[model samples]
Target: MLSIILLAVALSIDACIVAFSYSLTLNKNLIKNAFIFSFSSAFFQAFMPIVGFFIMYYFGLKFIELAKKIDHFIVFFIFLFLGIKIIKDAFKNETIQIEKNLSFKIVFSLSVATSLDALAAGVLIFSSKLDILDCIFIIFVITFVLCFMSFCIAKSIKLNIKLLQIISAIIIILIGFKILIEHTIKHI
Candidate 1:
């Protein structure tokens, strides 16, 4: 239980950061939108591990091992590419601003993007023979709480939204690089 909680908190760090970024762009009903985003992310984080555990339990350890190898690189590349794209989008002459009202599509996209790392972590948790239910619950609770906290913090702060966006992009890119380096080191 302790280990599961620890892993959940560890995995939630990225989600917290992403939630903070989203908060900056949000202008209206911040709490509502933030909760929705957080819930989706947390649920996915929790659910993915169970799914992975089932896959491993029913299939084979060999498949899980292979998945672990590619997971890191896949997540890293996706984040890196998305970060670069966000940076580019930010620089365009016609800046596309996100409205205060939350949409399913936007929330869904953000949830998927931010919680992708958790999906990768899910594979690891499954292989380690940890209790999937406990881990998933911990992850869901942790991410939800942290994301809400981040949203509140963001709402309280009086900073430039554009600057926040740039910072968010940088943070994501750094995470991607960190993941890449960690995996490369492990392989070598």
Candidate 2:
């Protein structure tokens, strides 16, 4: 149980950063939009692992093994792209003032983008020796709670929005690199 909770918190760190970014753009009703993104992220994070677990348990280990490599590559590439984009935007001095309300489409898209790493995490969890259902539930709970807390902190801060975004991007990129290295070492 403790290990499951720890893993969940580690996985949710990325979602928390994303949620904080979204919060910067949402002024009024920030909590509502935060909740939407948080819940969606938590749901996907939880859902993907269970799906991976069942597929691995029922079918065979071959698929899971194949997926692990793909997941690592995808996450690494996605974070690399995002980090470059953020760095470029930082230099361009193109500031985006967060609006009071966020559109449903925007929220949904952001949720998906931020949770992509969690999808890879799901595959990793499935390949591990943990209890699948319990791990998923713990991940969902931790992600949702951490996301909410990040939103609250974002709302309270008065820092430069662009800088905050760049920091978040850097953190994500670092995590991606870490994941890639870990997986590569395991496979080798």
Candidate 3:
């Protein structure tokens, strides 16, 4: 249970970071939109794992191992790309304008993109022999809590949003490196 909780937190970090980024711009409708954002993030975070698990579980054990190899690489690159994009935005000459577009499609896209790592993480949970339902439940709860917390905390801070975004980007990049290094070491 503890491990599952930890894993859930790990998978939710990206969602939290993304939430923090958006929170910086959200001066109005904060409460209503926070719930909406949290729900969207939690829904995808929980749903993706189930999908990844089912896809890998049916594919056979050999494929699971193969997928693990590919998963780490994919996870690393995706986070690296996202982090780079955030950093690039931070360095832009124009003031960073937060697009407060809370449209379903845009929110859904953000949720899906941020939850990509969680999809790969489903395989890890499967390989660890954890109960899928319990993991999903824990993931949903943790992600929702953390993401909302990040949103609230971000709004409270007076620091420059661009600096916070850069810090968040560094964290994302570090996570990507950590995944790559840890998995690569395991293979060795």
Candidate 4:
């Protein structure tokens, strides 16, 4: 349960960042724009994992026996790579430029783009003991709450986005280490 919650937080960071970033630019229709983006981000973040999970569940089943031997490594590598990627992306010069006139296309694209990591993370769900529905609910709730809060927060203060990304990366890497350690101890 704790692990699921932690993963939810890590996965939702992207949505939160998007909401915060968008909110920073939005001057009018703050409530409407925030709600649309938050819901969109949350929906994709929740849905992509199920897609990834089913993809892995069907294909990965064939490799179950072999996978068990190195599942920890796979999970760790996925998270470590994700964490590194977050940090790396934070350093890049490119930034998403959105028109003040928030459109459905832009919202959808941002939601999908930000949730891609959750797709890879869905692969890890096979290794966890928790139910997929539970994971989905937790993820959906956490993401919506965080993103909505990000919008609220952005209205009041400017945030240091790079710093937030780095922090999120650290948390993800630590979760990977936690899973690795737990698996090793269990096997031993």
The number of clashing residue pairs in each candidate reads: 0, 0, 0, 0
Candidate with best TM-score = 1
What is candidate 4's lDDT per residue for 39-135, written digit by digit as tens? 8988988897787788787877554445445656765675677567667767776672223555786578667656766875677786674588989
Model 3 is weakest, by summed lDDT over 10 consecutive residues, at: 97-106
How much lDDT does candidate 4 score?
A: 0.72
lDDT of 1 at 107: 64
Q: Which regions of candidate 1 fall more than 4 Å away from where they truly are?
A: 94-98, 101-106, 113-131
Query: Which pairs of residues have clashing backbones in candidate 4?
Result: none
Clashes of 2: 0
Write one digit per residue (lDDT tens) for candidate 3, span 27-138. 5677777889998999999998887788778885666567557666776776787678768867776878444545576467568767776866678777888889999999
| TM-score-superior candidate, 3 or 4 | 3
Q: Give the higher-TM-score candidate: 2 or 3.
A: 2
Residue 96 in candidate 3, Cα distance off native in Å: 3.4
lDDT of 1 at 99: 55
Q: Global CA lDDT of candidate 2, please? A: 0.71
- Model 4 scores a TM of 0.62
Kindly report which residue stretches of model 4 are placed more than 4 angstroms away from their true locations once superposed. 61-101, 158-188
The best candidate by lDDT is 3
Q: For each candidate, what TM-score against the reference?
A: 0.81, 0.72, 0.70, 0.62
